[model samples]
Target chain A: MGGFLAGVVGACAEAWQEVRIHKGRVLLSLIGVAVAVCALSGAVAMSAIAQQATIEQADSAGGRAATLTMSMQPSDSTATGRQQATQAWFDVLDRYEISYASRVFWGSSRVQFPDSVQEAGMTVVDQPYGEMHRTRMVEGSWFQPGDSARLAPVVVINTPFWESLGSPDLATHPTVTIDGLGGAKAVIIGVYGTSSWDTWPSMFMLTGHFESLLDPVQAAGSMPQYEMWVPPDLARELQTRIQAELSGAVGAQGFVSVDRSDWGAQMDDPTTILRVITMVIGGIILLLGALSLVNIALVTVRQRIREIGIRRSFGATSGRVFFAVMMESVVATVVAGIVGVILAVLLVQSPMVSELVSFGGISDVPPFPASAAVFGLVVATVVGALAGLIPAIIAVRVKVIDAIRY
Target chain B: MSLIELTAVTRTVLIPDADPLTILDGVSLRVEPGERVSIVGRSGSGKSTLLNLLGMLDLPTTGELSFEGESVPAMKPGRRDRVRGSNVGFIFQQFNLLDGRTALENVTMPLLYARGPRFWGRERIAADILDRVGLGHRLSALPGSLSGGEQQRVAIARALVRQPKLILADEPTGALDVETGQSVMTLLDEIVREENAALVTITHDPAIAARSDRHFRLDRGVLTVAEGAARNAGRADEPVTDGPVADDAVAVL
Candidate 1:
């Protein structure tokens, strides 16, 4: 047992010395492995951060707004039925103590700016409440209550509308004409910003402003669209109450279609898809890195054939040679793994990397998990052992007599 | 009792796509404890082959060989290796001292292979052996850094370090100059005498053969006693001349 231990120590010392003497080669090999590990870990970290950011953004946007769409017959021209439906919804919401903003629905109409005319789906709201239906203004300002009753109608336009209109300074522009609806001239009161309405061109106006453009009879016949915001936890109860009251007052056909913002649900969320792709890519890179380590260990063993023979000649048994070579490979791979983990941590912490992640909409850097490091080390060691097996066998099987002759 | 015994020992070399070649042909020899013997032959005369067979590095094709009266031809490989490690020491023609190791480490190698744990006391044993071989000052120097004569002395130190019962040297001084070779031979003789170990040195150098207690000539797969004038003739062929009477009276066995 003592002799075996001594042999192992001697072999380890020799292996270390050889590595030291060929420092350049060892460093090169280590760099190969380190780069592979860094790429893998960096990719996983970046993808995870990006996915988390996207989910957070989606939740923030979707959680705040509650919408309900109702389908009515196109020819249902009775004001009594629309009024009853509106009253029923209002009473249900009031019963639940849920504060909501309502928008009267109108069909699609085109709005004309000086340089560009865009078709914007129109909706009329009485007032903004609970920060839920309020659009943030990028330039100019939101419509004031005083502007609601002005002779010329005041309208709020989204950013895309302003940009499409050649970015004109429409802040002081008193009035603009709408080709459809009533063809009345409307005043541009404010410009708001949002990525929420990216799908189509859209703008907002007060119910009075919209009513001013339409004839009294036409306005009376038009169905009003309503959008409401309620706390997410109270949503189910609120929805149930609205449905019950609307069905009772407006007949069995009267029903509310509650729409919860499902930004992530659409297209399965690109960020999550990207995260899964990045993870697969990272896993492949790690596997290649492990293979490279094995190749290096095998080559080292082949190169040390004569040395192994000499050790055997000195009375090292086959088992001893096998263990010594395997130990050397494992030690080398573990060292590389540690260095790789350090480099990965440093890369993730770098200012440039963090900035890039933030630019991709991720604000927080994920902490380097201890589990990842442990897993990497264990994998590297196993790769080392696998790589060492064949070579170790060859080393042990060397004939003492043939080795001395050489 | 003979320290080494060989009965009808034969070693053959088998090569693919070639006929089998016999290197040692049913030759037999023996040496008692404390006896210094030399086997002299030309190149390829089976001298080294016989040495290898005796050293347990090669197995005989059809013969029973013994070391210290124990049958070695039939021993297991592990047992053979153990016996070779503990009971037999070898000096090679090229001075096969591990080039990377210091002189002391080279000498201490056999002891390091002992079944027991190595202790600090192994260093003392190595030091003593190095001192005996007149290389006390060069103990820390690697074999490659040593001169040819110094390296040969280190090899001799290594061979004797285990205190083996038998020493097998194959042309131990074959690569050295006349002066260095003489010093090396003198050192080998002195160590073998002091340790009471049987020494069997195989060389083509007749002068070295004459210096031993008994000299045997190997030629054409046969061993023969070279005595009287023929033994002196072998001595006269020495690269360095010394002690003409001793050379003339040397007996062959």
Candidate 2:
């Protein structure tokens, strides 16, 4: 064991000396490898951020992972029929002990404008809706549990809706009037930012307040869908169990259907697709880098024929010579790999890069993945090993007599 | 036992789409410990091939070969290489000094493969040997920065650093002027005597051949003892003549 360790240490020292002697040539090859590793590592790190942005985007559209949405059709178009459906919703929630769930109603609310009254999109939801959807707020706060007890409706408006109302200060208790529905006043408690795809004015309201403003006939016509956040592990099994349980709970007064509505349940998950695409591109980049490195290493070995012969003539065995040649390349690339990883970390963590990769949406970009940096170094070592093989073989095959003569 | 022995040793090479070429024909030679033997041959007369054979760099096509009573041909390549490394030291006409290394580093090459104290104290051993060769001041000098004689002395330091049983000097003085050549040769001979190690000098120089204890001439792949090839103690080459460095060189050794 001691002899083996000595041999390895000796070979490494010799390799380092050779690398230092040929630094000019080593530097050029290392440049190619460094750039390749940087690009590959950056792509991996960026993918992590892209994945977070994609998840939040999906959460906004279809809610978080494992969120099941429930919808019901009433036996009759009457206020009592809708109330019975809502009662069934209450019973199921109480029985399951689920905490994060909300019933969402989609409609438009009449707003009093300076010149005339206009209709803006509105959603009637319970308090848990904003938290479940990762709703980004530009001002004020999301709906609180006590919001249900307010005499006047409390609403969260999007930027455009707030702009239509002159972007008022929430501390002053800004209110928008319901022009067509008995002229009811609604407090604008918060302003939520809009995604790039969203431009139209929209607002959110608590279910009780929205019902208080709109008449029973109109409230009965608005479609309400059930959503609840549950443990992802139990989602599939619970999805199956909920379908049967809810069907029985609502009984013959309504037809109920339950389905997993998160973007993850859908067939085309953009985040997974992004990861696969990045890996394929990164792989191609590394391969090109390795090929160039191998070419340069082969040329360098050919130039050192006499050196190899001298080492052999002294007492260097085939294994020692082979390992030394290979270690030279390995040492050079590992140093390059470290440089590349550092470059990648700095670039990925930079503000402009983070914003660009997240599409300007992800305020909390995920921390640089430690796994990505480790992956880069590991891959560089592997590439160095592979690139060194042919050159090492050529070096060991140098006949001592021929090399000395040359 | 002889330090190295070759009986009826032959070396042949086969070329693609051509007849086999014979470089050495049934050469036989033996040298005991502490003996100095020289072989002289014209260019391409198989002196190098014979030197390579004796150095274990090439296998004999057919023959009995032994180093200190161990059959060299029967050893594994790895074992044979180890035997060669531990027992034989080679000095080239061109010096073959590694270009970018210091004189001390060049001398440390053979010791890198050595185990125990030799490997650990390689630099010190190298420095000591360079000091013996009158190159102690040039230990840090690269081969390119050194003169021809200085570079050859560094090569000699490299060869002897391991203190091997046999030293093979292939045309060791072919690249130097006559006086410097004799100076280097005399230095080499005295060191081999001090170390009590066998020496084989392969050269075409008659004066260099005359300095050895015994001499053989190689002609067209055949070995024969030349007339008047025996070592003579009072040879004209030994008196230094007008060569100032010879006195210095021999005196240092």
Candidate 3:
């Protein structure tokens, strides 16, 4: 066993020396391998970013996974009836210890500037909406525990909306006056970053605070819907329970409908197709790279025929000669793999790639995955072994007498 | 016991569309431990074929050959390789030093397959042998940087690094100048004697052949020793019994 290990170590060292001696040719032959590994690992790293973008898109359209969104259309869907329905939904949410819940209501607020008035887009949400949607606060903070206890309704406005309000400082407790809230003032408690679609001014206010000052005609046109987050495994059962309980509380038979927002299912269909496409492309690149490597290794072995003969005469067995030749390719490719992976990290983790992926939306760039690096190196070694096989056999078949004659 | 013995060793090659060509016909020789023997031959003679057989690089057809009392033809190829690696070393006419390797690295090549502490301490052993060959200062020099005689000296160091029982020199100084050839031969003779190893030198020069303890000639695929050369040698106790002995006009050593 010791001798076997020594043989392996000696062969590896000799292989490294051979590579160093012929580095120019080795580097030329290794270009294909380096490019293949770079592309493969880069694709792997980008997949994570792609997946995150898919989840974010799904979250914006529907909601995150394990979230149950309930909607109802009752015969007596009056303002008072809607208030009763919301209260009953809240009771059910509190009973289940559902920490995240929001009633999404879109409305336009009449914001009065110093010189003129403008109608700006506003979203009414509970505190958890900020976290569930991966919203980042640019200043101050999301709704705190005592935020709802303040006299004026606290609203988190985007940068554009804040700028429309003359860029008031949050430290001085800036306020804005709205038309429909009986000329009441709204406090700007926090400022959040803007998305690409948020061209106009936008603000996020508490559901109850917005509802208190909402216009009845506007509320009638767009009804508020309740969404809540729960554990994924318990989502289906809880959805059924919530439907039954909300129907009983509101006395609205066949009106309540509960559905789960499955982000994983939304992600699987398209991403699986993407994954297959990626594999096909990566496999072709690797195949071409292997073919190139095989060609170069064949030529290299042919050129080293005399050297092989000399080594055999000096006590190297045919097996040793074969192994030494094969290991030269293996060692060279492994080093190239390391270089390619480092290049991949630099390429995939760059700010330009992140900017391209985010598209000025929510910046949710994930860390470069370690699996990609491992996969690249393992594949490189396997490719090296496969490429070197035929050449090593040819080298082993060389006759010592014929080679010495040369 | 003799370090190597060949009885009626014959080597034949089959060519396409032609009859089998006999390369070596009934060649017989024996070298005891620490003995020096030489074989002089013409260009097309069977000297190299016999040398290849003695070096264990090729097996004889329809002949009995043994090294240190072990049958060479009966051993497996892998076992033969091990025996040859551990017990036999060769010096080629071209010096045959690896192109890009240093003198120390070339010398350490054989010790990679040796057994015991010698395998583990190969670098030290190679360095000591290179120094003994007066190449200690040129340990890091490649073969291209060294002259013909210096490269042959490195080749000799490589051959002796394993301390084998038998060293086969196939025209060791064939590529060198006369003066350099003599000096390289002297170095080889001194090293072999100091190490107590048997030496088999195949040469085309009569002067080189005359320096050995015993001299033989190979002509037209047949080996013949000069008259009365083997009579005073120590191996006369054994006589040819397995194959046809040479005629009275020729003595087989």
C-alpha TM-score for every candidate:
0.64, 0.90, 0.90
Comparing 1 with 3 on DockQ, the higher-scoring candidate is: 3
Candidate 2 lDDT, B68-101, residue by residue in tens? 9988889887788888888889999999988799
Error of 2 at A176 (Å): 4.7
Give the least accurate 10-residue stretch of model 1 chain B, judged by summed lDDT. Answer: B240-249
Interface RMSD of 1: 3.2
TM-score of 3: 0.90
- The DockQ-derived docking category for candidate 3 is acceptable
Give one digit per residue, the lDDT tens place, for model 3 in A1-406.
8778778877887888899888887897688899898888888777767767666766765677777888865545677777677788878878999988888877777887677888878888888887776666778788986776676798898888888777887999988887756677888889887656777987888876876676776566555778888888888799889988888766644278888765743435546666667667888888898899899888888888888877776677888888988899899889878888998899988888865655554546688889989999999998888888999999889987667666
Q: What is candidate 1's lDDT per residue for A81-126, written digit by digit as tens?
A: 6666667767766876656555555566877766567677665666
Let me know the DockQ for model 2: 0.57
Question: For model 1, what is the error of residue A205's alpha carbon versus the real structure, in angstroms, after optimal superposition?
Answer: 20
Candidate 3 error regions (>4 Å): A109-119, A138-140, A158-185, A191-201, A216-222, A252-254, A267-270, A361-364, B227-253
Share of reference contacts kept by candidate 3: 0.36
lDDT of 2 by residue, A334-397 (tens): 9889998999999999999987888755645689999999999999999999899999999999
DockQ metric, candidate 1: 0.21
Better of 2 and 3 by lDDT: 2
Per-candidate DockQ vs. reference? 0.21, 0.57, 0.47
Rank order by DockQ, top first?
2, 3, 1
